[model samples]
Target: MSRLAVSVCLAALVLAAGPAFAQTATPQTPNIGGFPDSPAIPAPTNATYPGVIRYEVDATDLDRHIVSVRQVIPVTGSRITLLYPKYIYGNHADTGPIQLIAGLTVMANGQSVDWRRDAVDPYAFHIDIPAGATELEVSFQWLTQSDNSNWRVVMTQRMLNLQWEKALLYPAGYVSTGITFAPSIRLPEGWQYGVSLETTSFENGLATFAPTDLYTLADSPMFAGLHYRRVEIDPEGDDVYINMVADEAANLAATDEQIGYYENLITQADRLFGSRHFDRYDFLLGLTNQMGGIGLEHHRSSENTHAPTFFTSWAASAGSRALLPHEYVHSWNGKFMRPADELTPNYNVPTENSLLWVYEGQTEYWGDVLSARTGLHTKAQALVLLADRAAFYQNQPGRRWRNLQDVNNHNLLGYRVPGQWTSWMRGTGDYYDEAALIWLDVDTLIREQSGDRRSLDDFARTFFSPEGTDGDWSPRGYTFDDVVAALNTVEPYDWSTFLRTRLDADGPDATAPLDGIERGGYRLTYVEEPNADEKAVSRNWGSDFRWSLGFSLAGPNNRIAAIQWDGPIYRAGIGAGWDLIAVGDRVASAEVLREAVTAAKGGSDPIRLILRNGQRIRTVELAYHDGLRYLRLERIEGTRDRIGDILTARRR
Candidate 1:
């Protein structure tokens, strides 16, 4: 037989035997159990460390963004484990960057010793001490972020924000409060700095601080710049200083009226809490566009950064004034009276966030209220901002699936990751704004139930500042039950059920809690013109047509920034990131788009849009007929204005 005929015969035989092959037994799969984990590093205990840690950081290498460290740690045992910080306090996750440490060397008696990283925990390093070796010298370089690829660059040509936890490691056996550090830093020439730490001495460019516990050292970050100014906002009381740094000298210019606002902020906070937590406080304000932005909270200080022209352009920057108030409120809410789970022994332990809705949410509510009370934002602006928030939660689609309680875990799942479908996914920080709305509900309910004689302010004073601890800043832990007890003490009601109904409700039937708006004597209504706060925000964030066309435009080139889920444009198969090419017959501009939407209202015509999605070009006809809808708060007749009274400044 020929070779071709032989091949055809083989194929025919295989096809004829296919059924028999299919009837063969299935192959058995291998199964294996996981290998046992290495023994855990020593758990932290309350015993005090025998000796202090001598730590030094040389951040003078600004051009390369390298932070060099040399730490001398005293040792008593033969085997010791060192742990890199994993759970940053404000971040609410195990997000410390262990990958940034390079050129690590451990030395004993001037001889390099071998070290091994724990297989299960990469943040831990194990080393054996040689006989008669009293201390171990460790050196490493922290490669600070130099570009904008992932994180914000902390080091710039003219300024730097030094977070101490990023530079040093701690022994594993003792709690963070038991380990002490005499920390020092060397900065660039002619640069002044601001920190919450008490400076013991300064020589040349190096500054040395008093010996402090590991927990406090990490919390006291430094903001240094060539142009710096310090002003005492509360000189009559526990010294509260606004330590400001800027890239340019002119950016530090604060008019007398602008300075008055900050002074009013201190007074307003004092009256609201009716107690002091810290002996001294510092507002570390960075007025620079170059440094990595931060708004983190600490017990006695806060890290805040704004536009370089924050003082120079006060009126134009009104929308951003609430940042200081928000972070400052954390002193009473989060830093002092903290959640029990968040009061971890050390930085490596993970934290639970069941009460973040109260920690971050109520602070957000009080932040805006304090902003209004201190004249950071006008009373009219405050109402408009409230209206905007009301409309947002009312239109949000994520509530159909995720409730407020479950959303607290989002910090660990995906913190700060942007989403194309953000409205449905509900990003991590929604607790800030959404919880604010819930607290508003609580505030209004309290006032109504008490016949206007009591409010959330009473709850804050009684709960945050208990009896006989007037000037204490010690950490006081609380549980969910404690929160309920405090609320009931302020106003007698089923506080637990009230909070759970709003926190645990989900599915297709769930809706926003807007009873607060109604009870506060305002009703959320749509208008043809944008409110003042919205217009000011739109100047930089682009136009918002969320209610009219169910989409908004932002960023460069008028691209679709956000599209409402299952709304007009979404139902029409148009999505975000589509660049607007034209609106009807005119070039695509905010004005042109508004005109097109208005023209289509009450008419048979569809809103025509020419959009370029990637390389594909297509024309979409939106069936939306609503014309330029914007949200505003209207006063309800014959009802008390509870919201106004809530925001009104309290007399000392």
Candidate 2:
């Protein structure tokens, strides 16, 4: 037999030895590669504890209907503890006490031990260990119903709950936390497995990997499936793993071409940053059945989902590529150098760290700039994106309802009161939009002041210097004042007031500073309607509009039980207990109804509705608006100098 085949055969024998030894065996040393001179993995100085010891989870697909997960977390030392968050961060609402972890089973040194749930908070769980316990093992099952939107094992349908399959096992503080994950799936015999972790070992149908440390582990997200292609672009110089997971029926040749595009984008980003931080950084691409896109950032990896055809269309591909850059940049902005308190304490608690504008907004700005800089997007395309964001915020009715500080303080208070209003209210719009503009302003300021010798990159490197002592950067969380202070370091002129007036408050002169862009040989104009060629390439879902009456009606098996008055239905002569069988010759399907509504065209046409009251069938036409509302654009002739000069200014 070949030497490589022999090695694989021996490894298989070791894995087949069973769980008792696997559970007790000491962890193997990490094989650090790539940079020989890189510093050793930093250890926790203040605390003498093992950081994220070991994690094992098994989630079985029960009858192809429901999946249940049983996890065992082993920690170092005689005392073992684990935390189950009452609510995951970014979710903002309590998961409600249903005991997701039911009937705790604890074993210490092959003997069962009694344990109690000590403390419960929105973010963590605390478990105790008895005396003389050398090793600890915790086993609990989480029931996942097939139709349960509240809990999900793989990808969640809700956008806000994207990272639902997350668990944090902290052997220490930020210094260490272990995560355990298992996708609910049934694998075919001899199927190959691909993951993003630095280590890959499979035993008893479970894959395991101990990341570099807590930080790197938290940053690496895992995706498991049979249909995927693993491409390693620069394995020797910079370790980049791309796990492109798609539907089995997808076009493999086209997928390869798209992967090449992504590989180039990531390589360029690394070049811009000047350093590769992680030993193994990965991108987990989950292909969905329909049209939608989302990207979540982990410490060393990112979870990205999009349709396969996204690469076929110029507009769609450009937008998806733009999203990739923003999420990848988070490895620095949102991961390594985070708001210290926000990292440890609850994120919902309000703070004055207006720097999210810098984090989220500056990142948003860079997404476009980097795309254009790398020749992935044209200058005109980038400008259109910026204009779209700006116009969306400018047209909102709630732009004057709140300030940026107030929005930051109440960002987590749910969408209706603080959340949704904060997102949609344009008083300044989300920081992403305003921050992009602010970055442009700062870039202009730096260029003008330093004769184009310094730009926002200087500010970024100075503030987010990985080599600097943590305290030298923002420690107690950065405020508006801190940002202004950082800006003054480069400009050295009292430019703080300029930022506050333009960004924090609405002023007539807020956009005046950008006028110099025209003088610098660029033109700016907002376009609403697409030209003939543009419309030809765009996807249209046809024009058929429908409106919901203000009332909510519910029934079992399509039979009406109660009617909610004050709903659009009640005003439209539809009463409670009226059975709704059709909405214009089509039976209603919850799935298809929403799709039909969003794709409907806007016009003053009445919707045809059929309802059954007792044995009588009543038909009515509901009045609805069906017109397309869009932001228009046009390029100005011979106005490049006027607009370019404004765009090149230091401050508005």
Q: Give me the candidate number with maximum lDDT.
A: 1
Model 2, position 423, has a per-residue lDDT of: 24
For candidate 2, write residues 282-351 as lDDT tens digits: 7776665431344666646777776765544445555445766677676666565554434533221223
Error of 2 at 401 (Å): 1.8
lDDT of all the models against the reference?
0.86, 0.48
Model 2 TM-score (2 dp): 0.65
Best by TM-score: 1
Clashes of 2: 53
RMSD of each: 7.7, 15.9
lDDT of 1 by residue, 1-652 (tens): 3334545565556556767774674433321221133335899999998899999999899999999999999999788889999998988878788899999999999999877787558888888888888999999999988776777688888888888998889999889999999999999999999999999998898999999999999988988888999888883565898889998999999888888888999999989998888888889999988887889999989999999999998777877899999999999999999888899999988888888888899999999999999999888888877887888888989889999899888888855677887678886767888889889999999999999999999999988888887789888898889999999999999989999999897899999988999999999889887655767744543378877787887766778767888878888888766988899888898778988888888888899999898899889998877677888889999999999998899997
Off by over 4 Å in 1: 1-39, 531-534, 537-542
The weakest ten consecutive residues by lDDT in model 1 span 27-36
Q: What clash pairs does model 1 have?
A: none
